[model samples]
Every structure is written in C-alpha cells, then in structure tokens.
Target: MDNIRHRHITSFQSGYDPVLEPIVFDEKRKTKKPFRISSIKLKNTLAPALATIRNFYNKYYNIIHPLSFTFLSFLTRFYLISLSDVVMWDESHFGKFASHYLNRVFYFDVHPPLGKMMVALAGLLAGYDGSFNFESGTRYPEDLNYTFMRMFMASFGVLMVPLAYFTSIELGFSKHAVILVTLMVLFDTAYLCISRFILLDAMLLFFTFMTIFCMTKFHNQKCDPFSANWWRWLIMTGISIGCVSSVKWIGLFTTALVGLYTIEDLWNKLGDLSIPKIDYLKHWVARIICLIVLPILIYIGCFAIHFAILTHSGPGDSQMSSLFQAGLIGNDFAENPLELAYGSRITLKNTGFGGGLLHSHVEEYPGGSGQQQVTCYHHEDINNDWIVLKPREIEIYDNETDVDVEFVNNGDTIRLLHLGTERNLHSHEVPAPLTRAHWEVSCYGNDTNGDEKDYWVIEAVDDIYKKTNRIRSLSTSIRFRHKVLGCYLRAANIGLPDWGFRQVEVTCDKRNNPKDIFTHWNIERHWNSRLPPGGKANYKSKFLRDFWNLNVAMYNANNALVADPDGFDILTSKPRQWPILEVGLRMCNWASDLIKFYLLGNPAVWWSGTVSLIMFILTLFCYLVRRQRQYNDFSPVQWTYFLYVGRICLIGWLLHYLPFYIMGRVTYLHHYFPALYFSILMAGFLMDHFTASCSLKTKNIIFSIHYALIITIFWYFKDTAYGVYSPNIELRGKKWLNTWDIVD
Candidate 1:
C-alpha cells in the first residue's frame, strides 16, 4: 500500500487547470498517466458507468457515513455502561462532589460546576437518595442507583464521535478521513473507560468537540453575513465554549482558540475590498457580543448557580474564610453570635498558606513536641474554640458585657485559652512536625497561668503597623506574632498521621522570612461590640466580594497543592506521555474479583495517531515548500478553504495541549482527550490528501481494515476498560508496545 504510485498527470481540479498536465508514470501499468482515483480503464477509455459508481459513493456517503459512526460509538460506549457498580478511580472525588450537590451542601471543587451538577442531576433522576458516602473502595449501596449516572456520561461520550464526524467534514476531509476519526474516538478504550464512570471527561469532551464544530460551521457561513443560520452557529459556538469552561479551566484553551479565530476573521473582513470600512463595525460588534460578552455572562451564570445551590456548609468549608462560612446555613456564627472581650470565648482563623481554624486536641503527634497537637480544622468543632485572656490571668470568665468592655488590643501579651482542653495556644523553640525549620505550636496544659513562651501579640495582619490595632470581627485578618519564640504563627498545608486526626499542622514561621502568608489569622466567628450589630443574613450581603475572595483562595490553594508533602496525586501523568498512551491506570478492584476496570487506550489507534501526527507535520512542511507551488492551480479556492479548516484544528490541538506542559497542578491522561480529537482529524486529512491517487477500492479496503483492527483492539483490551472478568493476555498477540500494560 505504501508503494502505490502516483498516476499520470491528466487532471488538475478535474481538468480545469492545464498547468500541471505533466506526464507521470503508473508503476502498475508502466504507462504514463496523471494522478486519479478511478480504475485503470478510466485513464485509457472514459466510461460513464464507472464515473456514476464513483459519484454514487460520494453523493450517498453523507447518509451512510453516520450509520457506521453511530454503530461503533453506540455499541462500545453503551455496551455494559454500568459494568462496574462501584465508584472507581477519580470517581471518588467527582462522585463525592455529586453527593454534596444532591444534599444541597455547599462545597468547592477545582473545576467549575456544570459537569458535576449534571452528574448530581443524573443520580437524582435515577432514584439515588443522596445518602451514600462514595468513599473509595466501598461497595455502592444496595438501594443507590448509579447506572443512570454512568449511562448519561456514556451517552455524552458517544456524541463526541458524531461531533468529530461533523468537525472533520467541516475541515473538508474525505469520507474516508471522516470515518477514520469517528472510529478512532469510538473504539478508543480510554474514552469508553473514562466515559462510563462517574467522571467529568464526558461532558468536557462533548462540549469541546462541539465548540470546534460550531466554530467551523460558523466560519463556513461567512458568505451570508448575519443570516439566521450564520448567527445561530456563531451563538452556538460561544455557548459551547461557555459550557466547556464551566466543566474545567482546560476549557480556556478552547476559549483562546475561538478568540484567535474571531480576531483573524475580523482582520480579514477589515481588509476585504468589497465590504465598506464603515460597515466593518458589524463584524466587530457581532464578534464582541457573541464571543466575548456572551461567554463572560454564561461563565458567571454557571458559578452563580453553583453558589446558589450549595447553601449549607460541607467538607469544602475548611478552604474558605470565616466570614464566607458565616453566609452558609447551619454555621454557628450565622445565628449564635459571640462577642469581643478579654474573657470572651473565640476561634481565630489562620489566613496563611494552610487556611484552617487554629485547633488542638487531646493527643500529640508522634516524635514531635510533647504538648498536645495544635492543628487546623475545617469545621468549627468545640476543640477549635478558644478563650481570650491576659497573660497573667487565671483563665476565669468575665460575662458582664454592660460594663466597660476590656478589648484585647495590640501590644497586649495574651494567650489563646483552649475552651475544650483548658490549654493555651503555645509555641516553643522545638521544630514543627512537617516544616521542621519552623517552631512547634501546641496546646500547653496551662492558659491564663502559662509562662512567657505562651504569650503572643495578636494584631490585624493588614493593620500591624498601626499602634492602635485590635482584633476585629467580620472585617480583619490577623497575625499572631510570638513574643518569646520571635516567630509568627503559620500553618503547614501537610497533615500529620491519624495521631493528629489528619488535620493541618500549625507552626511558627520565622518573622524575618518573607513567605509569611501562613501566619495571617482572622477572627472568623468572633462575637464583638466594636461596631453595629447585624442579622446573620448579612453574610449574604457581601456575595460578590466573597465570590472573588473565594475564587482567589481556591486558585492559590489548588496551585500550591503540589508544594504540600502529601498532596501529590497517585494518578498524575505528565503532558508529554499522554498522546502516546504510555501508561495505564488500574481503576477498580473487587472483594470477590467479579469485575476490574482498567483505564487504557487502544494501542493501534493511539500509536497510529502519534505517528500520523509526525506525518502531518512533514506533509504540512512539504505543502508549504513544495506541493502548494507545484499544484498552485489544483482547485485554488477549495484548497485555500481546506487549509483554513486544517489550520483551525491545529490551533485547537495546541490550545488544549501546550498549556499542560506549563501548568503546575496535577494533570491526568484524560486531560489530553480533547486535544486528541484534533490530532486524529488532522492526520486523517493528510492521509486522504496524500492518498488521493490511490483507487477508491484500495482506500476503502484500507480504512475498513483499519476500522476493524481498532475494533478488534477494543475487543482484546475490552476487559481492561469494560471491567469484565477475563484472563489477562495481549489481544491479537499484537502488543506492539509494552506501554499499553493490557492486563487482559
């Protein structure tokens, strides 16, 4: 097949161009001829019947192509979609989020809300009661229904195949190229595996594919400016971008592609000779409204819905501010307000790197300071609450608020009286458990009567220079500057073992060092009379402010996660290894070995796609340097449009990829699936373009064989992705690469 020769030069754009009538040899016939796709007889003798047969396939391919795409996509993605009843792999993380959504509990995720919200809705519709914990390794509860959730995402995953078909069509690929991409996605085991689980990849891939499809369709509609379908496609493109953005920040790559394309379109319109300069405003206004303004509004709306639904506090509260928690229902300070006084009970929240409430329990971390562990807790436990007292007081309560209230002020040496343990928040010269360079913070047995080392100067972090600084409620972030240790209080993001209840470690960071963010503390739930009193609902009054604050907080937390000792995720994969299908993840195991789902892609498709990418680059270089000039008259208009579509695909791939190489956060192989859509389509275009001289019979046979082989690869790796119990062996004895790690 690789040795198939180019036929004689007889037709350029089907004989319209006479420039490239140069004679070439047909190695099969040893006769001179031009490049053509028909049978050998057509070169010597023009036959009407042969021409009709070739034209029939081209004309009817549009109708028949979908049948093939649907068969493969539906059969694989839908087949045993619920093969694994248990939540597998990263399902623990996303499934837990869905459960939180079902319970109307406010929580946070690194991703935007739409995808998980859809999963929660799917579970709810499927009769799930929002009761299961979805903890890792736990069997799915008897009454809980997860089939619908898996099926919903699987169906979304299947749509990606058809969307790829249309996207390839818009890129001017031949029917063979379109079918290749469709089958590539449909039979790829990774998609089948990830999509059938309670995962976010399905919604992400679907929206991303549709975004490119809508973009191409919109670009094609340029001839009819502002026409109904043109506007519809344009709006749909923006909506698709918004939808994907709501799934993950990876969607930003798609957003960037659209922005670039819109700019290019506007540039072309500005330079067009036919369109008057005054009328160019239409293009500018339309692009801005649909591409920029619409996407921004939709993105904000997604977060708004996310915030609106999660009204009650849940696991994610630990990462938020004390004032932010005040807005959530069931939080104590929401109704049972506290006050500011020398003897008032209080809880001080650390606003530093590891944001958590300063907490202590009855136990000590192993091999660390003998004092009780001082850690950070996400929730407001009784252990987290503390009493405020002067350095030498007896830790006695003074409840009379009518008299002149003695407010703890700056420069006043004080100790944090642990309300539950009667211990004070004390720091000594001993090193911290995690960040050993820092001093240890723990609960010492004595509070009001504690020694000088327990004394700390509590000043507002933002107002530390002001001599009159005092602890403020609902308005200030504070810093605990140790008097004796000469260090500022800080929290290490890392957690101790079960000995410390797996809570964040609180320590003393040196004051002179600049990385002092972890030392800033805020009186999150403090009760005080420094200002006017307000209702608990006042937390909702600062919605927009809280939104920005929460976004920044979440961003920093996720970004800094890698720096945490225990934060590195097991499933993390480097960006470079994704496209080659270099590794596989074992997703599930059973007590009885009934089913085991492994996440891996089809080696043939992935491996070929990798090689095809290399080939496409070479072809592109050849086109620019040689082929474009050699065939300058080869359907000039059509070739220009085809290259434009191909360029968009290339850009889309780069947008979704390349960014991963630079991101600091943990990523997985599934993140590259969006980019794979473009890589496969681009390769398909070059394959068909280069093989245009081959007989249709040969091309069809090659594609059919390629399609069947991938399906066979799917069958061999079926147990790996489908979670069926089967003996482990390489399928077809064709394990071309050891990296596939195909168990069965």
Candidate 2:
C-alpha cells in the first residue's frame, strides 16, 4: 500500500504523460531505480570554445615564462652591441677623470666623486696587474681591462628585470599584470643600453628608484611618523637622493619632488587630527623633523664624506681642502682645519687653479662683411646668446671631439672656411678633388643675410710667363657662403688685358648682398701697373694654412674653445660652475635620452624593469607594514596594482626621453612623459574599480581578454626580439678579463 502511495506521489511529481510513469520499488531485491532515463548534462556547455581559449593561453604563457624571461632579458642586452663599441663622447671624459683619480692627481670635476669613484673602484678591482716601470721604460700594467667595468653596469641593467617583476607582484597587481609589466621592462632597449655602458646615469637611476620605493613604503606603513625606524628610512632615502644629486644636479629636481610629496602627505594627516590646533601643529612639527630635517641631514652627511676625501691635501688623506678654500665654504664640525687652510684653488677651468692651466679664450675672426669693425667683446659678462660659448654652448661641446669640415675650390685663388654641424660626417658628402691653381675656403654663417659670417681663405697663385709680344694679368676672388646645412666657398679668376696691370679683391660681406658697402676686402690683390716684355709672376697657398683654418672653424663651430678675458673669475660666476653645468647638462641628456627610447626605440620595455622593481619593493613594504592599521582603510590589492601600473608608466616615460637627452639639453618631451604615464595608470586603476562592480561573467570575460592580449603581445614581441641586436661580444671578453684581474 505504501509503495503504491509512493508511486502515485512520484507519478504526480513527474511531468508529461509519457514521462509520468512512476518507478516500482524492488523491495524483495532491496533496490530501487528510476522508471525513465535521460542523458546527463555536460559540465561545460562551451567546451570547444573553452578548450580553444585554454590552448591559446597555455601557448602564450609558455612562451613568456621561465626560460622566456631569461631569453628576453639577454636578448635585450645583446641588442646594445654598438653602445658598448662606440664609447659615447661623454664616457671618454669620465674615463679621463677616473684615470686622474687612479693616478692620484689633483683633479676637480664638477660632479661629485660617487660616480667616478665607482668607476675608479671598478678599475681598481679589474685593472691590469702590471705596474709602471719608469726605469725599464715599460708600463707594468700591460693590459687595460675595461670589460669588467662594463659588465658591472650590465649586471645592474639585467637585475632591473627581476626587480621590476617582484615590484609588480608586491604592488598587488594580478598575476597577469605582473607578468605584463615585467616583460615590458625586460625588453626595454634604452635600459639595456644604459646598463651596458660605464656611466653614472644607471647608478643615478638605481638610487632614484630606491629613494622612491623607500618613501612610498614609509607612507604606506602608517607607523608612528616620529619613530626612529621611520627616521632611519627617511635618512636612507635622503642619502640615496643626495647620492643621485651628487652624481648630477638634475637629481635635485627629483629630490625636491619627493620632499614636497612627503610634506603634503604629512599636512593631510595633520589636517585630519581632531586634537587642538597647537597640539596638532606640534605633531606636525615632529613629523617634519623626522621626514624633512633627517633627510637634509643625511644629504649633507653624504656630501661631507666627498668633501673630506676629495679636499684632503696630505699623503694618505683624501680631504678636498683645495675645493673648500676655492669657495666651498661652510664645513661640518668634523672638517679638518689644516686641510682647509692649505686648500687648493678651485677654478672653473680646472680644479687645480695654479699657473699653466688652460683657461678658455676666444679668438676673433673677421665677421660677416669681412671688414665690419665689429668688436667681439670677449667679455666675461656677455650673455649666452652673444657670448657664443655660454653654458648652453659648454653643454653642446662637453662631449664632442670630432666635427665636420667643408672645402670648395674656385678656379683661381683657393679660400678655405670651417663649418660646424652636429651631423656626423660619415653620412654627408665627401671632399671633392682639387687640381691646378684651385683654391678652397670654409666659413661659418650666423644668418641667411651673412651678417655674422667668419671666413677663412686659402689661395693658390699660378706662375705665368709671357712671350715677346703679349702681356696678361691674372687674379682670383674667393667667396664663402654659410648655410644651415653647411658653409660653401667658391673661388673664381678674372684675366687682365695684355700690357695692363690687374687688381684682385677678396671681400667678406656681412649682408648677403654682394653689393653691400659693409662688404670689405679681407685679402686684397694688387699687380704692378705695367707688365714687362718677358716678366713672370708666381703665388701659392700651402696645405698647412688651409688645414689650420679648417681645424679652427671646426673647433669654434662645435664650441670646443672657451674664452675668458678676466682669467678664471668667470668660472665662479652664478650658474656657471663646471659642476653645476655638468649636472644640468647630464640631466638634460638623461631626460632627452629617455624620451627618444620611449618614442623611436622600444617603448614597451625601455627602462620599465628598473622602475617596476623599485615600485614593487616600495608597494610591498607598504602593504606589509600597513596591513594592521590600514587593513580596511584601502584595499591592499588595489593599491598594489595601482603602484605596479604606475611603475610601468613612470619607467616608460623616462625611457622615451633618453634620445632627446643625448642630443639636446632641453625639450618638451621631458615634461610630457611623466604626466602622460601617470594619467594612464590612474585611469586604468579607475576602470578596474568600475569593472569590479559588474557581473562575475562580465568580469571574467573582461579579465580573460585583457590577459589574452597582454600574453599574446608579449609572446610575439619576445620571440621577435624587437630591440635585441647582436651582443657586444668584444665588450664581454674585455669586461670579463678586467673583472677577473681586479678580483684576482
């Protein structure tokens, strides 16, 4: 009866008439089964699509992970082969300074010793094993190893990749984002180039990143702002910033930015206090002391070390007393008095300001119009525009040694002029052949009107003999034209009638107008009034004079020469110190270089690694430290992700400006890169937040697509090795040998 009743209930529960049949209970057999059967539902309805997606992701992920990271990192480095071989113009200058330090010479470099010191350290560790044997007339150090020093920088470059990856992870980026950011840094060409070279820029960047990381971490960690530990970190940050500043003054801008950011953060915290204004002010004051005061102290402290070591005068003492006496006033309590008293004169021309130093000078040539009594003041007070070789000029010539020279020949007398252009000669037109009484001249044109043209003339006079009945006069005129591309000079000759005297005049006109009154003769040609029956005339200009003028103009055009009327006094002039100038110059170069890398080089990967690493350390430290109090204050994951993205943007922007920095000192790109990258990161974070509020399916799809794109793009570029060129194999061997010798 129960079974029948159950069967009736089951029949009612079942739907359609055909499917409504109830199952009978097999009581005797102790088993029960359904009367109707149906196919099982599949776990994944879109299995085929899912399988395809999975396979795609698997392939992409496999290409970029583990071995891919190593391969890509190395490939990026390899592409910088030319960078190692070329030895940029600036590197040579730095090498000279390093050599000076090694030889214990009294040298004065505008930049602090930290960067050069590192180079010296590299040299000491890896330089040749032999010594200078004056008696034997041989240098004991037969091998001048450079590979180890280069490798040191290269290692720094490679380390940035891992650092960036960890930083992204720490910043709370999703696994996919972390991977994306890491790959971006690993493949950056600019970073690879910088790291492979023996320059302070890489060091400055490393320290800058470090300072940023430490400061961000401190802010995130909501510890007692006045605590010793907090102060310690602040001090460390200050020291690092100072170290960067020591290398280049441009680092000061970053320092200032960080300082302001800290103050603002503190100000906001104080504003939120509910306590009495005075009490809050007191707390704020304490915060300032810890954050601001401590940092300043640390900076000064680091500087003090350089001051002492570089200024020391006696044997076994590295005090830079001469620098102190030469106007590095204000000393810490620990400074040595004797060292200060016997200090060396710190002149702008050279740190060793004694007699025989090569002070800059200007040699005036005939300006445009060739005869305008235009006075080149040669005064120290001339502004940069009028000064011709001002600070900007110094920046231009700071690293240039080779320059372009153009020569042209007119049929008659040869005129030579020197034209200076930043363009490499290797790409431009070569010199043409000069034959038979031809003249060549090179000149500089300051304007299209030729108002400020300096011309150099080289003339070749031909020997002529007349027969019994005929007489003739011959003359040559040399003309020089200056243009933005280069200077052009041409020489032409005119014949005088038989039995008559001829006069030739070579004039330089300030105004392009050949008929202008200002145009006066620089070289005048005069012949005897009458010609004899069988007389002969001869004239010629030698190669020495022709080559000399070309060389001079080349130097002048490139701004290699410096002129000072009042001796070295102008060097100490405001904003004119070599150190200050060097800092500004290097900073500008760094900014420009970053810009170029961002646009024309590898945008995705350039400098991203170092930046990512720095941000990761900072974000991680902040998350871990602030976990207790700020557990619910802000989402750790969100903040971390924001920082990770921010790191990518910051590095990307910096790398983009690199080329500009190398070519010029000032540019619009410098200001834009930082702003653009920051905005993108902020916007992306906001989007992420908004997307999280949508349905799970929507979120999953969006995330999957994002992941898929990043993975695919990274894989494609990684395999293609866009920026990875041939490795500087020579540099490797050189650096390795140097390193081994130094260590040994």
The candidate scoring highest on TM-score is: 1
In angstroms, the error of model 1 at 541 is: 4.8
User: How many steric overlaps are in each model, in order?
Assistant: 15, 72
User: What is the per-residue lDDT of model 2 for residues 1-744, given as tens digits with 9 covering 90 to 100?
Assistant: 356323443444655453334465677887875554332335455677889988887888644564567666656654433332333424565655556556654344445556777776776787733232122111123365556666665555565555455444344454545555555455433344455556665666666555555555555455465466666666666666766665654456556656666665657666676656776676567556655676556545544544444432222111121122222222221221111000111111111111011111122213222221111111122110111111111222211233331112322211111112211111012221221122212222332223222322222231122222111112122222432213333211121122112111112222344432112111211111121111121222233332232223222322322334336421112211111111111111122122111111132222232333345556557766877565743566656545544544454434333333343222321222222222233323333444656777786676566546544544543311222232333213222223111011
Question: Estimated TM-score per prediction?
Answer: 0.78, 0.42
What is each predicted model's overall lDDT from 0 to 1? 0.75, 0.37
**Candidate 1 residue-wise lDDT, 1-744, digit = tens:** 444444333355565544443345667888866544354555556567778888997899887778777777878787887666766877788888888988889887777788999989888888887888888777787787777778887888888888988888887788788878888888888888888888898899899888989998998898998899999999999899989887877888888988888888888887898997666888888888888889878888877888888989787876776676777887665543333467666777776533778888898767766878889887758888887777774444455545566766666677788888898888888889878888888888675356788778875555321224555554565677898878888875676677788788788887555346677776766654442444565443256655665676667666754534557544667888887887776676633355766678888777877777777677667767766478663477866765676677677787888988887777777878888877777767767776788999998887888879888888877776776565454243534566544444
- State the displacement of the C-alpha of residue 465, model 2, in Å, after optimal TM-score superposition: 76
What RMSD, rounded to one decimal, does every model reach?
12.2, 24.1
Which parts of model 2 are misplaced by more than 4 Å?
1-89, 106-110, 128-142, 162-172, 223-232, 275-291, 297-303, 307-600, 605-744
